[model samples]
Target chain A: MIFLKFLLYVWMVLVLLGAFFYAPLAKGLGEYTRVMYFHVPMAWITTLTFLIGAIYSILYLRKKDIRYDYYSETANQLGLLFALLATITGSIWAKMSWGAFWNWDPRETSIFILLLIYAAYFALRSAIEQQDRKAALSAVYDILAFVTVPFFIFIVPRIYSSLHPDPLINTQGKVTMNGKMQLVFFNSLLAFTMVYFWMLKNKLEVIKLKMKLKQLES
Target chain B: MIKAYYIFRKDLLQEFKTRFAMNAILLFAVVTLSAVSFAIGTFTARQEVLSALLWIILFFSSMSGLSHIFVKEEEAKTADTLKLVASASAIFLGKFLFNIVLLFLLEIIVVPLFIALMNFNVQNYLLLFFTLFIGSFGLAGGGTMVAAIISKSGAKGALFTVLSFPILLPVLVSGISATKIASQEQGWMTAYSELQTLFAFSVVIITASILLFDFVWNE
Candidate 1:
């Protein structure tokens, strides 16, 4: 675990260096585009964690395992934290690129909706008292929320483009990029994804220890 | 399927006998309409604004009563008895059907009063009706599912709206756009895309709720 922690830090440092020094300035947006390195990855981790939560939710429902339920709840909690960060960072990027902090861009709206969905998840959790009942309900809710992510990601963007001019989307829904930039982007993405797993692992362990302690005391 | 109707019939019977859900839905609808009319008072509202307000009224009005469908069963302690008698899908369908009927009835009374009071003109009545019709199904599907999830939770009032908003947004977007087309009297093709989107959303939510209902209902 210590080795893994060391490796994650090393990876993160490499990504930072690559993002600032190695990655060439993207066209048009110049300095503003650098935000993409963090913004996109943060958004990715947000979606990934919620999806991870939903998968664990499904497993918990099927297996009736308290551990899986804990993982699901933890994943959603982390997902909400990452989603909020992404939204703030994204707003900053929007301010720089679009000359406004909030424009109701499809991407912005998608993240906002995602934030609400998970916020509701937390609210649902708090409102239920029974252990197994709360877990069951939240797990089902998690899966239901996950089902909408695809609609937001794909359909929302299409609605925007068809209804209005898309400032950010490139032709054919693909942004043309050379291999080097792709490498740096993917590198940062991988580094952040690793960071997510490490945090989640640590969170789970801490909670597990707390549960054991509670059991011993009781 | 037959069992589903039995649940539906049962809910309809109960709703009619007490007029409980109906009265709550209409009172809220009328109150909201009155407030909106007062707020927008004499402003020459745009068609989009008019379309949006109509849905806002419908949305909240539905929320007033729809959240109670399952909560009623749980509160009345009939959930367990119903659980024994009906399959999960039957209960889901029954509740969903009842919600749809409630929304339809709400629209019937509210939409006319909404247009008359707000002086909102509908150029394509057919399209407006279709949008509301499809939107109702989408709302019922998602709302009933959420009501079930939060039935035993403490904060039904807030959780239902908070949880419903995000999922309902896509529906509202399509509904607003479609309503705009209807108000503007745009050609059928103009509203087709939004119609398609609304239809797609309804299908996805209902199918998902059906498949997932067993776990939520049984647990």
Candidate 2:
């Protein structure tokens, strides 16, 4: 954990330097393209956490284990946080590039619905009082929400052209990356993923400790 | 399969007697459609706006009562008997079929009234009919499973809508787009892709729900 923290800090400084100094400013975005470093990673982390949560949910249903339930619910909460940040940062980026805070662009709509999905997940969880029933219902919901992710993020935006060009990818499926830009983008991706793991580890520990405390009290 | 039919028939009989889902949905539809006509009265709305408005009414009206398929069973304490007597998939089919019927009845009433009230023109009657037909099927399919999932929860009504909005957006988007094409007198080929999306949406959700229903329904 300590190593992971140190690595994250080092990667953070590198990302700051790489984004401003090392990465080349493109034609259209100029300085605003730097926001891609933060926004893109947040989006990636958001999708990744959601996938993790759904996988754990599926495992929970199959195994009938409460451990997997904890994993699923925690990951979902984390995914919601990441998705919120992604939306806000993406909104800032959109304001810079497209002259609006929220254009309901495909990506914006994508994140919005994603937020709704996770929000609904929590709502369903809260509404159910029984332990087993809550786990089972949330597991089913997690799987269903994950199923819609591809349709929202990939298919919907491509259908409409109101999407101003994405930073790393164009609508045409071509990678528009130069050498330096590619390096920084990939590094940010790696750094955010490590940060995700470190946070997941801490969250799992916290939940585990809480359960222990409840058991002792009982 | 026969057991599922029996379940569906049972629901039909009860609903025929009570008409709870049907009455609620149709009444909601009438009131909302009236309000919409009043709001947009005497103004020429775009084909897309009109199409979206029509769908908005249908969507909310459907939501108002779609959970009856499962909720009624739980409400009256029949869900336990259902668990013992019928297979999980049978229950899903029974609920799914009931929802489709309710939606069908709703459109049959609202469509004519909407066209009459709002001066909503449709150049392609067949395409408009097809869009409503398939869109509601998709709605019923997803809504049935979702209805089942939420039936066991305490806050049935609120959870149902919140959970359903994300899953059903693709259907609404494509449905609205297809209706727009049909309403604007665009070529049938123009709405073809949206129709394809709707078809795919229906197929995928129905299959997934059916496959997943046992896991959800069985406890």
Top model by TM-score, which number? 2
Question: Candidates' lDDT values, in order?
Answer: 0.86, 0.87
Error of 1 at A148 (Å): 1.6
Model 2 agreement with the true structure over A100-155: per-residue lDDT tens digits: 99978877887899899888889889889999999998899888878877788877
User: CA shift at A129, candidate 2, in angstroms?
Assistant: 1.5
| CA displacement after TM-score superposition, residue B203 of candidate 2 (Å) | 1.4
- Model 2 interface CAPRI class: medium
Candidate 1 lDDT, A20-133, residue by residue in tens: 888888666568777778888888898789888999999998899878899999998899899999888888877887788998877888888888888888888888899998
Give candidate 1 regions above 4 Å deviation. A162-175, A211-218
lDDT of 1 by residue, B1-219 (tens): 899899999998888888988999999999999999989888768989999999999998898899888988988999999989988998899889989989999999999998899989899999999999999999999999999987877776778888888888888888998998899875799888789888998998999899889989898
Clashes of each: 0, 0
Position A17, candidate 2: lDDT: 88
Q: How close is candidate 2 to the true structure, as a TM-score?
A: 0.96
